[model samples]
Target: MDEITGVFIQESREQLAEMEAGLLRLEQNPDDQDNINAIFRAAHTIKGGSGVIECHFIEAFTHLVENLLDSLRNGDIAATPLLATLLLECCDQMSSLIDVLAAGTPAPDAGLLARGDALTERLKQFIAAQTKQPEASSAALTVHDSSVEASGGGVVITDSWHISVRFGRNVLRGGMDPLSFIRYLASLGEILGIETVTDAMPAAAEMDPESCYMGFEIRLQTRSSKADIERVFNFVRDECDLRILPPHSNLADYIKHIQELPEDTMRLGEILVRCGALTQAEIDDGLHLQKDLTPEAGLEGEGTDQTPPTPPPPQLGEILVEHKVVHKEIIDAAIVKQAQVSDNKSKEARLVRVQADKLDQLIDLVGELVIAGASANLLAQKSRNGDLVEATSVLSRLVEDIRDSALQLRMVQIGDTFTRFNRLVRDVSKELGKDIELSISGAETELDKTVVEKIGDPLMHLVRNSLDHGIEPAALRLQRGKPATGHVSLNAFHDSGSIVIQISDDGGGLNKDKIHAKAVERGLIQPTQTLTDAEIANLIFEPGFSTVDQVSNLSGRGVGMDVVRRNIQALRGAVDVDSVEGEGATFTIRLPLTLAIIDGFLVGVDKASYVIPLDTVVECIELKNLPTDRNFLNLRGEALPFVRLRELFEVEGEPPPRENIVVVQFAGKRAGIVVDQLMGEFQTVIKPLGAMFRHLRGIGGSTILGSGEVALILDVAALVHAVSQGEEHRLLAPPARHKLSAVQNVRQ
Candidate 1:
C-alpha cells in the first residue's frame, strides 16, 4: 500500500477504538450529551477520512453509522442498550474493513459485504424511526454555556448560521471558480440570504481582468455542524479567509470570530455588518455618531476655531458598546480564546509523525555504537595513558546517555493496551450470562513497544481463562456469600527494572484437588508425589493441562497456557500463579523493561565469561567469607542457593582457590552465582542465540565483550527456578553432594 493509505488505515483504527470507548461510556450514562457528540465525531471523522482516500466500501458503510450517531446527538433517539450494541458492532465491522485495506484487498469479500449490508439495513431503521418523530429543541445544544438562553438577552437571536468569506486575488488565476464553492455550500443547507461585496473592485479602466477581488456575507439555515460547514471550504482554504457563527450564537462567539479574521482594509463597521454581528442600520448609526463626535466634523469651512469642545472621537468597539450592540465581556473572552489558540498552534507545530521501522533502525545503530564505545574504552585503559583513558571515559558516558534516550523513544504507556480489554470483558460477560466488570489500575506504567506488542496475546489468554474458568457464575457467586457481580482487574507496575502485570479475579479460586487429580491422570506427575500449594497452582502452565471435563468454545481445550509460558520465556521473562483455594487466584507476569541494551555485571568461570543483568545483582562477596555446604550458601543468617557456573557448564578446569559469589534476585527470590572473577560492569547488547540453542537453559543470549570474546548472558529467571527446584528435589529425595560435585569430578 502507498504511505497515504497506510496512514489512513492506522488513523481509522484509532478512531474505531475511540468510538468503541465512547459508546461504552454512553451506555453507562444515557443522558451524556458530550459522550454522544464525541461518538458522533469519531464516526464522522472516520467516514470523512475514508472518503478522502476513496475507500468507498468503508465510507459508504460508515455513512449509515454516522446517521444513527447524528440522530443520537440530536436527541431524536434515546441511548438504548441495543443501540449501543449495534454501534459497537459497527465499530468492529469498520475495523474489519480497515484490516482488508491493510492486506491490500481491492474490496471486501462476499461474506463481509453481506455483513455490511445487514448492518446498513439495521442502521437505516434507527434513522427512519428518528424521521417519524417530531423535531424538538436539542438538549445537546443547551448543554454548552454558549447557548443563547444561558446568556439571557445579550446574544444574537438568529436561527440561521452567519458566514463571511473573502477570496484571494489570485483565485481566478488559479482556475478555481468561487461560485463552485458557493454552489456546493448550498447543497448542505438553504441559502437564507447572500450579499456580494465588490468593494475591492477597481475602476473598469484600471482593473486587472484575471485578478479576482470579491467577498460575500451569507446566512444559512441547516442542522449541519460548524465542522461540516468548514469542510466545504477545505479545497480553497489556502486561497480564502472564512468565518462561521452558529445559530443563536452568543456575543463571545462573534467577538472570537472577529479576532480570528484576517487583516482587511474594510472599515470596522462594515466588518461587523459582514460578520452579522450588527445590522447595516445599527452599524450606519454607530458610524454616523462617531463621525459627528470627531473634531474634524466641527471644523466647517476651515475657519471655525471652536476647539471642538475637546471631546475624544469614539473607536468602533467603544461605539458598538455605547450603542448596546455588543458587550465588554465578549471582547475579554475573545482575547483569552485568541491567546489559547496561539498557544495550541505553537504546540501543534512541535509534533511530527515518524514510522515505527525508522525508530527501530535507529535503536539498532545505537546498540552498535554502544558496543564500539566499549571496545574503545577497553583499548584506552589498556594503554595506561591518563588523557586517553579520560577522553574514552567521557565518550563512553555520552554513548550511554544516547543509548538510554534511544531506548526511551520506544517506551509507551500500557493504558491503550489495557483499555482494549474493556470491550472483551463486556462481550465475554454477556456471552457467559454473567455480570462481570473489569477494573484497571496502574495502567500508566510504560514499557518497550516491542515488549508491549508481544505481551498482548499472552495477556488475552490469561484474561479469557479468568473469565471462562476462573470466575464462577453469578448463581454460584451469590451462594458462596459473594456479590452477585464478579470483578476482574488488570494491574501493572514497575518492579526492579521489570514490568509486572497481574490479572486477577474475585471468584471461586482454583480447586487444588481437581488439578492434582487431572495432573496424575495425565501422568504429568507421579501419583505418589507431594507438592506445595504454589507448585500445584503453577502446574496449569504445563502443556495440555486442564481440569475441565468437557471442552467448551472459550478455553476448555487446554491449548493457551503452555503457549503463554513459552512466549514469555522467549522474551527471557517468566510467568507464575498464586491461589487462595476459595478467595481467588492471580497470575503474575514479570518481563524486562527492554530487550535491547542492558547494564550487565561481567563474571568469569574457568576461562569463559558470563554477564548478569546489573539490575538483578544485589551485591558480590568472596565465597570464602560465607559457609558453603553442598550447593547453598549461608549469608547473613539466610540460606541462599548458589549455582556454580564451572559445574553447570561442565568446564574442564581445577577450582580456583578463592571464588566470588554474586548475589542476584528475581521475583523476590535471591541466589548466589559462584564465579572465578568479578569483572565489574559492562554494557551488554543482547543478541539472540541460534536455533541450535533453543532448548538451552541457564543461558539466555550472547554478547560481545571489548576483548572480542563471546560472553553468555545468563537467563536469571530460569537459573533461579533451577535453584529452587533443585533445592526442593534435594529435600524430597536422597541427596549426595547436590549433583554438582559429580559434574565437577567428571569434568576434572
Candidate 2:
C-alpha cells in the first residue's frame, strides 16, 4: 500500500472508534445533540478520507451511515437503542472493511458485501421514514442580504444557501470545463438562480477561445452543510474562488466565513460581496459615499488656501456600519475568529507523525547503547585511571538518560485499552440478559506500548470471564442483597516500579468449594490435598478446570482462564485471584512498566551471576547461623522464606562460606535469595531466554553483563511464590514439622 493509504487506514480506525463510542453515548442519552453531531462528523470524516484514497467500498458504505446520522442530527429520527445498535454494527462492518484493506484485498468478499447490503437497507428505512419536505420553487430568486434585512436586524428568515464562484482564466486551457462544475453543484441542491459574468472578457477581436473568463452568482436551496457544499468544488479548489453561506445564517456567520476564507486577506467590500452578504452594486454605492466623506473630497478653494490634512480613506468597515450595511458586532466576531484560527494553526505546526516501527527501532538501538556503555564503564574501572573513570561515569549517566527518553517515547496511557472493553461489556451484558456497567479509574497510568499491545487479549479474556462467570445474573444478584446492576471496574496504578492492573466486579465471588471439587474431578489436585481459600480460588487457572455444569457460548469449554494466566506469565508478570464467598472476585496482575531494561541488584551464586530487580529487593544481610535444616530466616520478627540459588540452579560446587541473603519482596510477601557475593547495582538490559530455558520458572530472562558474561535475571514474583508454596508444602509434611520446630526454636 502507498503511504497515503496507510495513513488512511490508521486514521479511519481511530474515526471508527470515535463513532462507536459516540453511538454508545447517544444510546444512553437520546437527547445528546452534541454527541450525535460528533458521530456524524466522525462518519463524514471516514467517508471523505476513504474517498481520497479511492476506497470506494468504504466510502460507499460510510455514506449510507452518514445519511442516517444526518437524519438523527436533523431531529427527523430520534436516537433509540435500536438505531444505536445498528450504527454500532455498521461501525463493526467498517472495521472489517478496513481490515480487508490492510490485508490488501481488492474488494470485500461476498459475505461482507451481503452484510453491507443488509445494513444499507436498514439505514434507508430510518431515513426514508421521515416526512419528505417539498423543495422550494427555483423560479423566484432573492439575494442573501435583502432576505435577512427584510426580517429586521441581521436575522435570516429563509433556508437557502448562497454560493459564489469565479473560475480561473486558465480553467479551459487546463482542460476543465467550468460548466461541468456548475452542473455538479446543482446535483447537491436546486439552483434557485444563476447569473454569469463576462466582465473580465476582452473585446471580441482580442479574446482567445482557450482563455476563459466567467464567474457565477448562485442562490441554492439545500439541506447540506457548508462543508458538504464546499466538497463539490474540491477538484477545482486551487483554480477557482468559492464561498458558501449557509441557510438561516446571521451577519456573524457571513463574517466568520469571510475570516476563514483561503486567501490571507480581502478588502471588507470584497469579503462581504464574496460571502453573499452584499452585492457589488451595494458595495460600490457604499464606497462612493465613503469616498465623498474623505477630507480630500471636502477640501475648499481647490489649490489656494492652507493645506488641510487629508484624513485616511474612510475605513470600509466603518463606512458599512455607518450606512447600516452590516453590524459592528459582526466585524468584531470576524476579527476574533481570525485571531483564534491563527493561534490554532501555530499550535498545529509543532506536531509531527512518526511511525510506531521507527520508535521500536530506536528503542532497540538504545538498548544496545546501554550495553556498550556498561562495557566501557567496566573497562574504565579496570584501568585504574581516575579521569577515565569519571569520564565513563558521565557517559554512563548520559546513556541512561537517553535510554529513559527513548523508552518514554513508547509509553502510552492504558486508558484507551481499557475504554475498548466498554463496548464489549455492553454487548455481552445484553447477550447474557444482564444489566452491567463498567467503570474505569486510574486510567492515566502509562506503560510501555509493547506491553500494552500484548496485554489486550489477556485483559479481554479476564473481563469476559468476569462478565460470564464472575458477575451473576440480575435475579441471582438481587436475591443475594446486591444491586440489580452488576458493576465491573478496571483500575491501574504504579507500585514499586511496576504497573498493577486490577479487574474487579461487584457480583457473585468465586466459590472455593466448587473450585476445589472441580480441581479434584479434573485431577488437577488430589482430593486429600488441603488448601487455603486463596489457593482454592486460584485453581480456576488450572487447565480444563471449570465449575460450570453446563457449557455455554461465552465460557465453560474450560479454556479462557488458564490462557489468561499463561499469557500474563509469558510477559514476565504474575496474576492471582482473591475472592470472598459472597462478594465478587478480583484478579490482580503485576507487570513491569517496561519490558526492555531495568535496574537490577547483581549477585553471585558460586560463579553464576543472577540479577534481581532492584525495586523488589528490600535489603541484603549476612546469612548468619540459623537452623541448617530449614530455608526460613527471622528478619526482624517475620519468618521470611529464603531460596538458595546454588541449590535452585544446581550449580555444581561446594557451598561458599558466610553466604549473604538478599531479601526480596513481591505482592506483599517477603523472601530471601542466598548468594555468595553482593555485586551491587547494575543497569540490566533484558534479553529473552532461549526456548530451551523458557520453562525455567525461577529465571525470567538473561542480560549481558559489563564483563561480557551473561547473567540471568531472577523473576522475583515467581521465586517468592515458589518459596511460599514450598513453605506451605513443608508445613503439610510430617517430617518437616520437626525441622520447622527447630527453626522456630532458633528464631526465639
Candidate 3:
C-alpha cells in the first residue's frame, strides 16, 4: 500500500507541475500548437497515471481535460478565452487533488469533478460547433484521417488469438473512451464477433457518462498472435482484466464457453472459459475427476513441470532505465546507464542525493582552510625561515584557489530570478491598467546563491514600485511624447568583483520638487534644506515614506520600499538611485560577489589592523608631506576626500612618520584611506559578529588576521560617505595629553 501510494504521489506531483508550466505558457500564447500539445500531454499523463493507481476521481477529471486539449490540438476547437479559463481551473483542481493525496484523505471537493464534467461538455459542444463550420470540420476530419493512417503500418501478427477485455466500472468516467480502444484493436486484427457485455452495468440513473460499465468478448479471426492483441491494451492492462486464448478446432471449445466462472479461476481452461472460449459443463465433465488435481488445470500447470520455465534475467541497462523511469534519451546520453552493472559498479561514479547541509559543511571547511593558511603565514613570518616562508606562501596561494572554487559552487546565474519578474510585471500592469513592457538584460550575471535568494523580494518591490509610481499610464505617457507602452528594464552585471543589479524604467522621471515638498510635509526633511536630486530620490527609502496621494492595492501603504532598502543594506550591499526627468529612474544595487572569504588589503590605523576589500581599492599612494586642504588629498590633483581611520576608529597611537593612502572607489565616487602601513593582499574570511556589534560603524565585519588577532574589516562605503559628508569634523579632532595620542590619532 505504501509503495502504491508513493507511486501515485510522485506521478501526481509531476503531472501537476507540468500542468502548471503548460497553463502559464498557454496564457501567454493561446494559439501555440506546441503549448497546446504540452498541456494535452500533461493531462493525458495524469489520466493514465491516476487510472493505474485506481484513483478514478482524478483520472476521470483529467481525462475530460485531456480530451478537450486534444480537440484543441487537432483543430476541432479553437483555444477560446473561456477554454483557457476552464483549463486554469482544472490546474487549480489538480493542485487541490495533490493536497488531498498528501493529507491522506478523500478529496476536499466533489464540485471539482462536476465542474470538470461541465467543462468537458462545454468543450465538446465547442468542438461540435466548430465542426459545423466547413473549414474547421475539414481540418479536424483531416487530422483524424491522418491519425488513422499513422496507426495502420504497425500491425504485426503471427497466429490467430482471442482477447477478452473487461474494463473497470469507472473506466468511462475515468476518461477512457471505449471506442478509441476498439478502433485501436480493429487496426490490429480482423474482428469476427465483438459481443459487448452489459451484465455489470446498473440502471440508467446510476450510469455515469464518464465511467465504463462495459466489457467485451472478442473473437478476432486473424493470423495475429497473442502478443499483438496484448499490445493493443498495453497502456490500460493494469486497469482492466484481460485474457488471451489460442484458437482450437473442437467441440470442447463450445462446451467450455458456457461456464459460470469461479470467483477466482486458474489455468488455461479457466482462462479460456472466462474469455468465453469453452463452456463450463464441458470443462466440468471432461476433467470431472482431474479437477481436484491442480496439475490437471491444463497448460497452467506447465509452469511447475518441464524445467519450471526459468524467467529471463532483466537487461541491466533496461532495468536501470525502468527503475529511474527517466526518458530513454536521458538514459542513452549518460553512458553510466548503459554500462554493465556487475563489472562497472563503482561507488564514486554513482549519483547520490546528498543533503544540502553536507555541501554547506564542505564550504565551511574550505573557509577554515583559508583561515589556517593565514595563521601558517603568521607562524612562518615569525620563524624567519626562508623555506618555511616560501612554503607558506605557496600554501596560501593554493588555499586562495580552493576558496574561490568552493565559493564558485554556490554561484548561480540571476536569469531565472529575473525571468520570474516578467510575469509579475505583466499581471500588475494589467491590474493597474497600464501598458508596460519589461525588458531584461545581463541576466547571465552570477552572484552568490544565498544573496540571490535573499535579494529577490527587494528586487520585486523595486520593480513593483517602478511599475506603479515610476511608469506613467498609457494616456499620460502618450501626452508626454513617450511610447504608449512604458519600458521597465532589469539588468545585472559584475562590477569590480561585486554583482550590480539595475532596475530602470522609462517613465516621467521622479518629480523631484514634489518629492521634496512631500518630504518636508512629512517632517522627513527641513523646508530650508538644500538637496541634490540623488538625495531627494533616496528619501523614498525612508520608512513610511510615499509620495502617492492615495493608496491603492498595488502599493503606497508606505510599507514596501523602505523594507527593500533595509534588506539590501543588510547584505553589506548598497543601493543607489538615479533619474533624469522624463528619462526614467534606475535603482542600482551593488553586492559582493560572494559572502564568504575575500581578498583584502590589511592596513594599520592607530595600531589597529583593518582589512579593506581589495576589489574596491583602486591603488595605493604615499602620503607625502606636501601641504593640502584639511580634508582633501592631492592624488595627482584629483582632490579625493581622505578619511583618516586613526581618527575614525579613535585608536590611541602616534601618527607614523611615513603614511600611505589606499584609494578606493564605489559608485563612481572615490575616497582615500590614510593608514600607517600597507600590508599586501591577504585572503580574509568574513565572520559576522553576533547581533551585539551589528550597529558598529566603520567596521563591516571581523576577520582573523595572520597573527591570530581579530582584524576589523573597514566598511569602505560608510567611510567614504563620512568623508563626503564631513559632519564629524569636531568629533574626529583628538583631545590633548594624550597630545601625542592626539597627534597619533590625527589631531587638529
Candidate 4:
C-alpha cells in the first residue's frame, strides 16, 4: 500500500505539471481542442489516482477542476486567460494536496485547508460562469466525450446490464472511494437499482475504518454500449472483481457470471433481478415452467408413485431462448465479450513497474561487468591462448552492447522539458508587459536523464534573460522594423555526439559597445584591448557584468549570465554566443549526450594516457605542422587548430619522435590534440575530479583503464572553445580572431 501510494503521488504530480503546461498552451489557442482534451485528461487522471489512493481532499478538489476543464473541452465555456490562470492555480493547489498526502499526513493542516477552500470557490465561480454562456454556442461544437470504446459490427447494444462489483480491502485504505464509481456510473446512464452486499463485513468490533468491506450489485439501464458501461469502473478494476452481464441474458449467463464471483449468499434469481437484467414476471414465469417440468410435482402431496419423465428437463437458458424471451444475439455477444476481457486481463498481468533507482543500480552493476570483461579480454590476449582470447572477445562485445542498452534506458526525450518553458515564457512576458512569443523546434531530441535534470536551471536562466533583456517591447520592435510581437526561439538538435540547444530571440541583439563599456568599467577587461563583436558580446558572462543601468525584477542583479556559463561548464559542456547587434542573439549550449558513461579514444601523451570522447574525434592524422607561433595546422587547405597536450599539461619526458594529431570538432569548430600514441577505443565510466583537482582545465573527468591506470577524459568541447577563444598562449579566453572572420581569412 505504501509503495503504491508513493507511485500515485509521483505520477499525479507529473500529471499536474503536464496539465499546467497544457493550460498555458490552451490560453494561446482556445480553439485547439486536442490540447484542451489533453488538459482534461491530465486532470481526470490525477482525480482518478487520488480516488484510488483515498486522498479525498485532492480527489474532491480535482473533481471540481476536472468539471470546469470538461466544460471548456465541451465548448460550454471558452478558454480565456482568466480561466487559464485559474486552472494553473488549481494545478498548484493539487500539488499542495499531493504534498500533504506524500508527507503521510492523515488530514490537511489549517493553511492547506484554507488554500484549498479559496481555490475551490474560484473554480465554482468559473463553473457558474460557464453555465451563463449561451447554449447555442456549445451546441455547434461536438460533445461526444463518453462514446462507446468499441462496438462490434452487426451487434445490438445492450440496453440493461448487470454489473457486480466487490471492491478490495485496500480500496478505501488506498484512497479510492467506491461510492464515486457508482456516481460515475449514474452519470453514464440511470443506475436503476443497487444492492449493497455486506456479507463480507466482519463484526463492528473487528471492522477497520480504512478497510473496504462493501460490495455492490448494480442494475444499469442506458443507451450506452457495454464497453461504455464497463469504463465507469476502470479505475477500480485493479482493486475490484467486476463482472457485467448484458441485458436480456438468460439464467445460464447469470449463473456463469455468478459462479465466477467470490462466494456470496445472494441467489441467482435475486442477483439477476437486482441487476435489472431480468424482470420479476419473466423470472417467475421461468420458475413456474421449471416446476411444471418436474415429474414429481403433482405426486408430492399424494402417496402415489411419480410419473415417468418423457424427456430430459430443458435448460433455463434454452427455455428462455426457445420461448423467444431473450435474444440469441445478446447472449452470444455477452459470452464472446467476456472471453475477450478475460484474455486482456491475462495479458495485463504480465506487466511490472520497476523503480528508476532500481534501474540505476542495474546500470551501475553493468558498468562493473564491463570493466571486468575488459580485464578478462586483456588477460586472455596476454596468455597467448587462442580459445580463451576468442571467448573473452565475445564476452567483451556482449558487455559493450549491454552497456549501450543500459544507458539507453536513461535517455528521455527532451521535449517534455522544453514544453514546460512555454508557460514560463508566457507568464514572465505577461508580467513584463512584453509581447514576446516563444517558438520551439527539434523537441524530439533525446538526452540522458541526469543531464536533462541539471540542464533545466541553466536553460531557464538563459531564457529569462532573453525575455527580460534581449527581446524589445512591442512598440520598440515595431520601430526597429520587426513585427510588433517579438519572437524567442528554442532549437535543440543532436550534433557530433552532443545535444546543441540554441536560444535565440529576434529583437535588438546585444549592444556590444555597451557591454564592452560595462566590462571595462567593471575592470573585467582592459580598456586598451581590441576585440571583435563576438568577443565583446562574450563579456556578458563575466561576473558582476550587466548593461542595464537599473535593476529589473526579472534580471539586472548582474548574477545570471556568469552562473549560466559556470553551470554549463560544470556539466563538461560549453556555451557561446553569436549575435548581430541590430538583429538578434543566439546562446548556443553544447552538452554531451550522457555524463555517466561514454565511448572514448585513448591516447598517450609521452607516458600519460588521456581519453577523448569518440564522437568528437573526427579523425586522426600524422603531425607535420611547423607553423611558427600560431597553434593551427593547414589540413586539406583548411586552417584547423591543434593543441599539444604534452606541452599544455606540462607532462614530463622527452618528446616522442613520431607524434600524431587527433582531429576533433566541437560546436562547428575543428581542433586537434597532439599525442605520442593512439591507444584505440575504450568504454569509459566517468568519475568526477577530487576537490583539489576541481580547478583543473581541459580535463572533464577521470576513468579507470583495464590495467587500473587512471586516464583523464579530455573536455573536448571546452578545449575546442578555449582554442577558439585564444591563440597558443591562452587556455580559454575570448577568441583572437572570430571563427567566421578566420575562415574568410583562411579562404582568401
Candidate 5:
C-alpha cells in the first residue's frame, strides 16, 4: 500500500479505539453528553475521511451509523443497553472493514458487505422508528437567509426553516451528486420549493462536461434543529456554500450570514426575504420593537433634564461568532481542521509512531555497543597507559548511560496489559452467571516491551485460571460464607530491580487434600512424601495436573498453568503460588526490568566465569567457618543456604584457598553462591541460550566476557528456589547417623 493508504489505516484504528472506549464509557454512564459527542465525532471523522479517499463502502455504512447518532443526539431515542451493544457490534464490524482495507483490498468481500448491510438495517430501524413517531413525523426546514428574500412566485414561506446551498465545482468528481444530496434532504423533510442555479455553466463549446456547476436554494419544512439540518450536508460542507436560517429569524440574522458569505449584505437580505425568512411583516415587527426600546428624550428634545430608563440603543449590525449559538457547521469545521494537543508530561508526549521493527533494530545496535564498550575497556586497562585507561573509563561510563537510555525507550507500562482483562472478566463472568469485578493497581510499573508482549498470553492464562478455578460460582460462594459477588484484582510494582505482577482472587482457595490426592493419582508425587503447604500449592503447575473431575469450555482440561510456569521461566522469571484453604490465592510473577542489557556481578570459579544480575546482589562477604560438606552456613546466627557453583557445574580442579560468598535475594528468600574469585561489576549484553542449554538448571543465558570467552549468566531466582527447597527437604528428611558414617567411610 501507498503511504497515504497506510496512514489512513493507522488513523482508522485510532478512531476505532476512540469509539470503543466511548462506547464502554457510555455503558457505564448512559447519560453522559461528552461521551456521546466523542462517539459521534469518531464516527463522523471516519465517514468524512473515507469519502475523501473514495472508500464508498465505508462511507455508505458509516452514513447509516451517523443517522442513528443524529437521532440519539436529538433526544428522539434514549441511550439504552440495547443500543450500546448494537453500537459495540458496529464498532467490531468497522474494525473488520478497516482490516480489509489495510490488507490492500479495495473493498470488503460480499459476505462482509452483507454483514455491514445487516448492521445498517439494524441502525435504520432505530432511526426509522424514531421518525415515524407522532411528534417527529413532520420535518421543520428554515429557508436559509440566501434565498428567503429572493423572488419566487406565490412562494409563501411559513414558520419553517430555509436552507441555501451552492456546490463546489468538483462535487460531482468527488463522487457526490447534488441531486442525491437533495434526495437525502427529502428523506429528512418535505421540499417546499426548489430553484436550481446553472449560471456557472459555460457555453456548449467551452464547458467541461465532467465538472459540476450547479447551485441549489430550497425552502424546507422540517422539525429538525439547525444543528441537525447542517449535518445533512456534512460530507460536502467544505465543498459548498451553505446556510440555514431558523423560523422567525430577523434582518440582523440574515445580515450576519450575508457578512460571513462572499456576497453583499443587502443582496443576501433580499434573497432571505424572497425565501420568506426576512419577510416584510417580520421586518416591520423588528423595527417597531426597535422604536419602542429607544430613549424618549432623544425623540422629544436634544438635551432633556432626565432620560427615561430603556434598553440600550441599537449598534451597527456587527455579529461576533461568540454571540451566535454553536452550530453543527462550526463543529464540522473544527473536525475538518482537527489538531492534536500534547501534554508536556505524558509518556506519549511529543511521540512519533515508529515501526516495531525499527525499535528492534535500535535495541540490537545498543546491545552491540554494550559488548564493544566492555571489550575496549578491558584492552585499555591491559595497556597500562594512564591517560588511555582514563579516557576509556570515561567512554565506558558514557556508553553505559547511552545503553540505559536506549533500553528505557523500550519500556512500557504494564498497566495497559493489566487493564485489558477488564472486558474479558466482564464477558466471562456474565457467561458463567456470576457477578465479578476486576480491580487494578500499580499500572504505572514499566518493563521491557518485548517481555510485556510475550507476558500477555501467560498472564491471560493466569487470570482465567483465577476466574475459573479460583473464583467459585455465586451461589456456592454465598453458601461458603463468601460475598455473592467475587472479586479479582491485578497489581504490579517494582521489586528491587525487577517487576512483580500479581493476579489474585477473593474466593475459595485450593483444597490441599484434593490436590494431594490428584497428585498421587497422577503419579506426580508419592503419598508417603512430606511436603510444605507452598510445595503442595505449587503442584498445580505440574504438567497435566488438575483436580477438576469434568472438562468444561473454560478450563479443567488441565493444559494452562504449566504453560504459564514455562513461559515465565523462559523470560528468566519465576512464578510462585500462595494460598489458604478457604480464603484466597495469589500467583506472583517476577521479571527483570529489561532483557536487552544489564549490570551484572562477575565471578570466577576455577577456569570459568559467570554473571549474576547485579541488582539482586545484596552484599559480598568472605567464607568463614563454613562446613566442608553441608549446604547451610551459620551467618550472624542465621542459617544462610549457600550453593556451591563448582559442585553444581562440575568444574574441574580443587577449591581455591580463599572463597567469597556473594549474598543475593530473590522472591523474599536470601541465599549465597560460593565462587573462587569476586570479579566486581561488569556490563553484559544478554544473549539467549540455545535449545540444548534451555534445560541447563542454573544458567539462564550466556554472554561474552571482555576477555573473549563466553560466560554463563546465572539464573539467580531459580537457583535460590532450588537451594531453599533443598534445605527445606534436608531438614525434613535427613540420613540416619550409621548410614551417613558408612557412606563417608566408603567415600574415603
Candidate 6:
C-alpha cells in the first residue's frame, strides 16, 4: 500500500479499537456521558475520514451511526438495553467493513447490512416521533426576513435580520434540502415567514420528484448572535450561495454590516438586499443614476487620487476561523494558550507502537557493541598509550550506557499481562458455576519483553490449574467456614535482580497423601520415600502427574504444568511451589531481567573458564581447610552445601593448594561451587549453544572473552538442583559413600 493508504488503515484500526473499548465501558456504565461522547467522536472521525477517501458506502453507513449517537448525546433516546445492544452490533459491523476495505474486497456481510438498515430506520422513526410535538412557544419569533424594501435606501437590519432563501434545480439530488437548513436555523431563532419559490419550476412531465426545483424566501427574526446563524449553514455553504444582513437600522449599522462582510462581498449590492442589508429599491436607484451619468464624465470624476476605497481590516479571530486552523469557540473556551501548549510536557505519559522486530535488532546490535568494547579495552591496555587508553575507557562507558538503554526499551510492566486474566476468571467462573475473584498485586514489576511474551502461556496454565483444582467450590468453601467467593491472586516484583511472578489461590491446598499415592501408582516415586512438604509440593510439575479422579475440560489433562516448568527453565529461570494443607498454594517463577547480558564472575577449573552469574553469587571465599568428609562448608559458621566443579565436570587436574569457592543463592536455596581461581567480575554476553550440545547438562551457554577464548556460562540454577538432589540421595543411602569414595579416589 502507498503511504496515504497505509496511514488510513492504521488510523482506522486505532479508532476501531477505541470504539470497542468505549462500547465495553458503556456496557458497564450506561449512564456515563463521557464514554457516549467518545463513541460518538470515533464514529464521526471514521465518517469524515471515509468521506475524504471517497469510500461512499462506509461514509453513508457511519453517517447513520453518527446520527443515532447524536440522539443519544442529546437525550432524545434513552440508553435502553436494546439500544446498547444494537449500538454494539453496529460497532461490530463497522469493524467488519473496515476489514473488508483493508482486504480490497466488497462490503461486509449481507446480514450486517440488513441489521444496520433496520436499526437506522428504527432510530429515524424514534427521532421523528420525538420531534413531532410543537414544543417551541408561538411568541418566540427567531426567524424573520430582512428583504423589505425602503424608499431612500434599503433598511439595514442587524440583530433582527432575516434572509429569503432560493434553492436551485437538482438541489435534493446533491444532498441539499431546504427543510433541514430551515430546521437548523429554527434551532437558533423563530421562523417569521417561509415562502416557497416555485416560479422557476419546469412542467410536471419534465420534472423529477427527487429533484428540488423549488426555492424559499424566508424572513427570520432572532436574538441569536450573527455567528450562530452562519454556523447553521457552514456545512452547505460551498454548495449554496449565502448572505447575512442586519435588520433595519441607522447608517451606522449599515456601515458596521458592510465592514462585517469580506472585501469581495461588499461590492455585491444585490447580495446586500437579499441578505437584508438593503432593499432592492435602493440598489435599483443606484443603478438608474449610474446609467444617467455620461461614461466619460463618470470616468473623469473617479480620479486616480480616489484610491480604491480601503476595506476594513479583517478580524484576527475571523481570519483564524476562516482557514479552519482554529475554532472561535476554542478561543472563547480558553483565553490563555499555556494550558494547551503544556498538555504534552510529560514525556512519560505518551505511548507509541513499535515493531517487535526493530527492538530485537537493537538488542542484537547492543550485544555486538559490548563484545567490541571489551576487545578494544584489551588492545588499549597492551598499547600503553595514554590517549588510546582514555578513548577506550570512554568508549567502554558509552557501550555500557547503550546496553542499559537498549535493554530498558524492552522492559514492559507485567500489569497488562495480569489484567488479561480478569476476563478469564470471569468467564471460567461462570462456566463452572462458581464464585471466583481474581486479585492482583505488584503488577508494576518489569521484565524483558521477550521473556514476558513466552511466560504468558505458562502463567496462564498455572492460573487455570489453580482455579480448576486448587480453588474449592462455593458450597465447599462455605462448609469450611470460608467465604463463598474464592480468591486467586497474581503478584509480580523484582527479587535480587530477577523478576518473580507468583500465582496463588486461597482454597483447600494440595492433598499430599492423595498426591503421594498417585505418584506411587504412576511409578513417579517410591512408597517408602520421605520428602519435605516443599519437595512434595513441587511434584506437580512432573509430566503426566494429576491426582484428579476424573478428567474435565477445565484441566486434568496433565500436560500443562510440566511444560510451564520446562519453558521457565529454557529462559534460564526456575519455578517452585509452596503450600499449606488447607490454606492455599503458591507457584513462583523467577527469571532474569535480560537474557542478552549479565554481570558474571569468571572462574577457572582445570584451565577451562566458566561464568557464574554475578547477581546469584552471594560472596566468594577461599576454600582453605574445607571439610573433606562432608560435602558441606562452614561458611562463617553456617552449613552450606558445596560442589567441586573440577570433579563435577570430570576435569583432570591436581587439587590447588588454595581453591576458591563462589557461594550462590537462588529461590531461597544456597550452594557453593569449588573452583581453582576467582577472576572477579566480567560483562558476559550470552550465546546459546548449538543444537548439537543443547541437551548437555550444567552448562547454559558460552560467550567470548576479551582474550578471544570461549567461556562457558554455568546454569547455576540447574547445577544447584543437581547438587542438592545428589546430596539428598547420598544422605538416604546409609553410609554407602565410603564405597563411592574409593571408586572416586581411584579416578582422581
Query: What lDDT does model 5 reach?
Result: 0.78
lDDT head-to-head 1 vs 2, winner? 1
What value does the lDDT take at residue 543 in candidate 4?
Answer: 85
lDDT of 3 at 641: 70
lDDT of 6 by residue, 1-748 (tens): 3455556767887786677667656656888876887788788888888888777778887888888888887666777656666676677677777777778776767876786688678767756866785675654333344534344643433334556455655567777777899898888766777777788788989988887666666666676645566677666554454444435432343333333322122234433443333344434444554454324333443546764433345443344335332234432322222233235444434866666899899888888888888999999999999999999999988988888898999998988688768657765886788888888899888889989888989998999988898889998999988999999999998887898999999989989888888888999889898876767888899999988878989888788989999898889999998888789998989999989888889999877999999989998888887556667767778878777877777888587899988999887788888899988788889999999977677778999988889999998887777666656656666685722442242222
- Residue 513 error for model 5, in Å? 1.3
Candidate 1, pairs of clashing residues: none
The C-alpha stretches of model 1 lying farther than 4 A from their native spots are 135-323, 326-344, 625-629, 736-748
Candidate number achieving the greatest lDDT relative to the actual structure: 1
Report how far residue 332 has shifted in candidate 6, in Å: 8.8
Tell me the tens digit of each residue's lDDT in model 1 across 502-530: 99998788999999999999998999998
Per-residue lDDT tens digits for candidate 5, residues 1-748, read: 3776777778888788778778767877888876787788788888887887788888888888888886776567899878988897898888898888778787799999888889988998888898888773232324564545433644344545667788988888889888888888888767988899888888889888778888887888776555567778889877886766565444444333332221122332243344333334333334455566555654654445674455566521112122222233432332222221112224355577777889889988988888888888989999999998999999999998898888888898987687678767876887777888889999998999999999999999998888888889888888899899899999999998999999999878889999998899988888899999999999999999888888878899889989999999999999999998778899999999988799999999998899999999999999866667677778789889878788777688889888999999998899899999999999988999999877777778989887779999999988888777777766666554322231222222
Candidate 1 lDDT at 495 equals: 94
Candidate 2 at 467: error in angstroms? Answer: 1.2
- Candidates 1 and 2 compared: the better one by TM-score is 1
